[model samples]
Target chain A: MIRHSLREALLSLWRNRFMNLVASFTIAVSLLVLGLFLLLAHNLRSVVAAVGSQVTVSVYLRGDATEEQRDRLMDSLRGRAEIEGTEYLSPQAALEKFQRLFPTMREVAGELEENPLPASVEIRIAEGHRDPDSLRQLAEEMKRLPGVDDADFDLPWVTRLRDMVAMARAAGVSLGGVVGLAAILTIASVIRMTIYARQQEIEIMRLVGATRTYIAAPFLLESSLLGILGGVLSLGALYAIHRHLAASQGGLVPVLRDLLTTSFLPRSTSTLLLLLGLAAGALGGLLSLRKISL
Target chain B: MVELYHVNKDYGRGNHALVDVNMAIEKGDFVFLTGASGAGKTTLLRLLFREEIATSGKILVDGMNVSTLSAFRVPTLRRRLGIVFQDFKLLSRRTVFENVAMVMEVTGVPRRQQRVKTYTVLEMLGLNHRVRSYPLELSGGEQQRVAIARALVNEPALLLADEPTGNLDPNLSWDIMTLFKTINIRGTTVLVATHDKDLITRMGKKVLTLDCGRLITH
Candidate 1:
């Protein structure tokens, strides 16, 4: 009987080819959009961590500051709990670093006799003090230090990037939830139509003493297959779209592909989405079956 | 055996479909439920099959209260009761062989035995040659026979047939009734609901007559 019901379900899916197609297509499209947003959010989070890790506060020294004053400032920074480490680059070292980072800038710097670059102390803040507000406060305190010409770091933009990543993630969650609901509703509507189409046959089955489960099992299996198949196809479509983005080098695709370098959704996330699809299908079928009597 | 005590089934708004109906039938008995249109004969059989619960009253079939059987237990009760309808109610998409086999499917019978039993029943009903034919291809009498075959395949203890011959001519009606008699002799109690007075008189069976939802005579 189990085999019979499964066979009946498969046969019914084939028999109602058009409706099944429509249902599957709707699920696929919805899941695909959800996957795209998730991928983007996942990538933006990576950007926030990467940018956060690379930024620091550079406290440039005045040319008139004595060696003793520079040494005192370095000791003060090292004693602070929020300052993880520091690197002091002399004027010559700073000019050498500049020449190495930008080859084109070396010609302009070489034309000047006195390597006119300020000696600066680059401070690496502790993880707890990495946010823009904390870095700005620390920079303000360092600016008042003796012989400090300027204290600055590329803080605002990285902080903005972190905020944007968080907002995008929240939006992704809402979008995924809305799309999942739409998929469930679509499956339920299609299953309801199937129930109506077989109303006469179902009535006869009930008359003959067939249990409600006996009649409902096949519909559940059919809808479940529809949803799972759609989920798998969405996964494949997302993969293909990412591959295209990764392979091409022109236009905005390259910028987008940089974020997607971690690959499609993680294996666990993929499995979860597939399971969610199957559950949605089963739930949809049961919702409609509730209206029927055994 | 079947028993009913003060069985009153109200459709709604105080309109009773069956009013104070009382009846009983022993095992292996053949009884006719006779009444005019709107007489509640169908409602009475439906109650026996547990299709509709009584608004007030008690009904016991083989010691199980038909009116109060739990939802899950209804299928168990129905398995022991064969039911037929005037329209034949055969699944048009299935062949005669599958249609008959489907009844046995619900009982979880082995497929091989299901095939054997279905073929035997079809052969007995003179449908062996049309085993592969769909219901739409069969005549009304043949379809009715298939319905009877399906009802009998499970060898139910009781058969509740509602208006079994309402859609047939006199000769076809008598033919189907003869099949019922044969089933009854085999120890399956048969309760048929119909208004065919000619056949009712011809068969000379115990007839329970209903008038306006009330038992006029038994």
Candidate 2:
């Protein structure tokens, strides 16, 4: 029975090749839109993770503070659990680092009578304490220490970046949902048209004592084939677009270049996308079958 | 083996298609249903196959109540019977071989059996040479022969034909009736509906005649 149905389905598809192609292409375009949004969300998540790993706070000591006061401040900071580790740069060492960073200004630094760069300690925040509120509280505590002149961190910038990533993900989900629905509906209408074209065949099948399942099997198989074809087509289009963007990063702006460096969807995600296509196609076929008396 | 008791079919608004029609045919009997157009001949055949349920009476085909058969069981009842129509109803896109094999395929016959059975039936109808031809590529008589091959492929217990030869010429119609008789001789009960008076007179078989939804002769 299955073999017979499959043969019938293949014959129908070949007979209506042009209409089926149009339907598949429409599904592919809709899936492509959804895939593009997913790619954007995926890349943004990578950016957030990269930025989060580098989160740190820098504390500058008062120039007139005694060595004993600075030592006590260091000891207190080291005792805190939120401080992962700290690197201390003396006044002379800070000046040397500044010269290395700004090579053109090295001559001006050399002409100075004394080192003017402040002695600072770079504090790495622990993974568990990386949230905005925790980091802000830690910075406030550091600023009140006796030998600390100021505590600085890009708190607002990191917070805003996180917010933007969240918003991008939300938008991707919404757009994908809407576009996926449209793709399913398109497939359903296409199947409906195929059913209409084969109405005579269906009536004959009925007269020959074909059960409902026997009559429906071929149509269901046709819909599923269309969906799977659409999925493969969209995946190929997505890969080509990703490859083009990745290969032409040199001409892109700094932000876009960074985004281009991110990898494509992972294996599990790609498989999930294909499954989505299969489900949409099956659902579309079922929706069209509802109208048939069989 | 078919029986109808007070079967009434109405198309609503005082338009009666079959009215209180009652008849019986024993197993292996060959009978013809004769009437002019709109004489309820077609309606009587339709009721026997459950294509259109009777508005009010009982229909028994091979001891199964067709009048009250559930939708889910209609296929089962039909599988025991063969039905043919005026239009031939052959799938034009399929080859002659495929058209005959379709009946067995739907009933879950194996591939090897389907091929063998389909070929044997085509040979019986003298259509084996045209197995590869499409429906439109064949003559009207040939197409009707293919339709008969399809109906008989399953070896049904009863054969019901509604104007099966309506689209053919007089000679073709006689040939088709001869084919039906040959099939009936094989012990399958046959019931045919037609308005061909001369053909009916020549065949000289048991016939049930109707006039305006009422059975006038039996």
DockQ of each: 0.51, 0.68
Q: Place model 2 in a CAPRI quality band.
A: medium
Candidate 1, residues A70-187: lDDT per residue as tens digits?
A: 9989988877878878999999999999999999988999999887889999998777789878898989988999999999988778778777777766776677778777877888
| TM-score of chain B in each prediction | 0.98, 0.98
For all predicted structures, in order, the TM-scores are 0.85, 0.81
Worst 10 residues of 1 chain A by lDDT: A253-262
Per-residue alpha-carbon lDDT of candidate 2 for residues A50-134, written as tens digits (9 for 90 to 100): 7776788888989987899888878887678888888899998899899999999999999999898789988888777888788
Best by DockQ: 2
Candidate 2 residue spans exceeding 4 A from truth: A55-156, A249-253, B216-218
User: Among these predicted structures, which one has the highest TM-score?
Assistant: 1
TM-score of 1: 0.85
Query: Candidate 1's residue-wise lDDT over B43-149, tens digit each?
Result: 89888888889989999997788888988788888888889998888899899998889887876789899999999889888999999999999888999999999
Where model 1 places Cα greater than 4 Å from the true spot, the runs are A55-155, A249-254, A260-262
| Top-lDDT structure, candidate number | 2
